[model samples]
Target chain A: MSFREKIHWVTLVTMILAFGWYFLVYPWRIVASPAGVMATAGMLVPVTIAIIVAMTVATAFLAIRSPREVHAREDERDRNIHMRGTHFGYYPLVVGIWINIFLIFWGIGQAEQLNLMIATLVVAEIVRIGTQLYLYRRGY
Target chain B: MAKPPFTNDIRTLRFLAGEMTQGDLGDRVGVTRQTIAAIEQGKYSPSLEVAFRIARVFGKPLEAVFQWDDAGD
Candidate 1:
């Protein structure tokens, strides 16, 4: 596989694992103080730091293994695939933001609204990465 | 996967051109080897500029390299 493809797989895996741990295992509601709301959210600072470190290591390894491919320029096909994936990604982000706005109009709680916003952003990123992988495997 | 309406003779041309590797052709054409493979396998239709560039690499006209299949579409 190309270096970019390998990077895609690594990022996708890391994103899923990190987000999965936060959403599935981290206890968000344990600390309910207003000031601690974001701190106690599913995505804690420590988890974010861990993910950053993991990604840095993975990228370093990839660059070391294939320095030539890492520096290679992206060509027409790569640009086309990126454009297509971004087009698909845009729809989810717009829809998510619209839903978040509707929730605000409906007078949802502050914490719930924040949660929805975070979830929407995560889903949008998933859509972007998922679509890129699909286009890479299939054809543009 | 279903084949695209466009078909190319890249594999045969590469073979005739001193058994050019996919990577070599991709390098000349400014694309990834995977993209070259995809085009040869009839799974992808390259853009106009890329198609012209591939033809130029083989010293052939674009029509000689790629043919449109009206029936396939």
Candidate 2:
């Protein structure tokens, strides 16, 4: 595969893994007792750190495995794909962020309500990367 | 920026230049390799300056490297 495609694959996989780790910890909160919830939340930080470390290591391996292609500059098709994909996702990003800010303004209540901002950014990134992968596969 | 109604023979040029690499040419032309490939694919048109630079690398006139095509329906 092309370097662009490889980079896309690496990024997509890493993002998904991060999301997977997040869901594993956050969505299972009900299973835990009060102390368990605190313990789980505390464990989340380290799990997140581990996920990041894994992603970094995997990316490094992929990059090393194909230095020529990975380091090669992107070509027209890649740029076009990226441009079209970024523009496609930009609208959703703006809208998602605006809604998130509105949620904040409405005082969504929880101290962690502000955490929605991070979710918004994450979702936008996911959308952007997904769109890029789709466009690359579909062509510009 | 808008992509102009233009096309190029970069693929053919690449063949003729003793199989010059897209990356090497991109380095010389001051663009990302992806941009070069996009231009060659007719998906994205480059700036006039870039177009001229590309033409210069092949020692051809700008028109020789690129031209307009109205075949799009």
Candidate 3:
């Protein structure tokens, strides 16, 4: 596998794990004050930051280890595949965010959308990586 | 994997041209040896610039080095 492909796999798997943790196992520590605090997804903000930092470190290590599998430059075909994947990645969020607005008007709160938004972001990235892998394997 | 779009006699041509090694051809053309291998196996095709480069190294025309067939695409 090429360096970029290996990086793609590492980033792909890391993001999948991070996404699941952010939306699933991430602890949302509730804080209380005179203003009062409610138990919700607030804990995720810090946890997600930590997750991102950790994954970035891991990916950087992988990149440093294998310089050749990594592409210093892209050939024509690589750029073409990137464009296709970018289009597909953005489409999901357009539908997702618009529907989110619709739901808010129908009385669903912002908190309800938080998990969905995180999920969409994760799935979008997964789709992006999958598209890259697919294009690499299947041709541009 | 995509079948190579072009067929080449690079291996034979190289041999005919004073037994060129993959490294020699790659260095002459400014790409890595792996790329040369990929091109030879029909797993990858070089860019026009790279193709022309490979041809020029042997003092041949572009067509003499790389053959493109649309059927693969």
Candidate 4:
């Protein structure tokens, strides 16, 4: 596999794992009292930390595994694939944000609103990685 | 499905040029071997500069290496 493809695989797997962890903790937060909810949300900070650590570790490992390919400049195909993935990824993000805005205007709960915002970002990332993986497999 | 708009004889040309590997051509052209493979498989159309570089690697003119397929239109 190309260095870029390896990077994509690492990112996709880590993101899914991190988000799955977040979802598993989500219900626990809902069942908490107001004070307990805040405490439970505090656990989310570790999830973010875990994601950052995972990304750094995976990237470092891949870069070390193929130092030459890592240093090589992006070519036309790489740029094309990046742009296409990012562009398509933006769609779900925009839609999610708009829905959140509509919810705000309609007077949704603050905690729920915040959750939606976080979910939006997560879903956008998932879309971005998924689209990139698909494009890489399909070729551009 | 319609055929790709572009096609090339890169695999054949590489063979003629002392059986050059995809990685060798990519190194000459400053791209990844997968990109070369993609081009060979008609899954990609390279930029003009890279296309020229590939042709230059085999000491051939760009037209001799690559061709446009009107059937794609």
Query: Which candidate leads in DockQ?
Result: 1
* lDDT (tens digit, per residue) of candidate 1 on A1-140: 77887887887888788777767764456433454356445356766787799889999999999887887788777887778778888888899889989988997666666666767777877788888888788876
Q: Rate the local accuracy (lDDT) of all candidates.
A: 0.81, 0.70, 0.70, 0.83
Q: Please give the range of 10 consecutive residues that has the lowest summed lDDT in model 3 chain A.
A: A30-39
Which runs of model 3 end up more than 4 angstroms from their true locations? A26-41, A67-71, B1-5, B10-47, B70-73
Report the error of model 4 at residue A73, Å. 1.5
Candidate 3, residue A89: Cα displacement in angstroms equals 1.5
Candidate 4 residues A1-140, lDDT tens each? Answer: 88888888888888788878776767544532455456447857887798889889988988898898888788888888888889988999999999999998997666677677778888898888888778777777
List clashing residue pairs in candidate 1: none
Clashing pairs in 4: none
Candidate 2 versus the native: TM-score?
0.72
Candidate numbers, best lDDT first, in rank order: 4, 1, 3, 2
Rank order by DockQ, top first?
Answer: 1, 4, 2, 3
> What is the per-residue lDDT of model 4 for residues B1-72, given as tens digits with 9 covering 90 to 100?
133697899999989889999989998999889899988988877889999999888889999999887876
Q: Can you tell me the CAPRI class of model 3?
A: acceptable
lDDT (Cα, 0-100) at A140 in candidate 2: 53
Q: Give candidate 4's whole-model lDDT.
A: 0.83
Each prediction's TM-score versus the true structure: 0.90, 0.72, 0.70, 0.89
lDDT of 1: 0.81
Angstrom error of the Cα, residue B37, model 2: value is 2.9
Q: What's candidate 4's DockQ score? A: 0.61
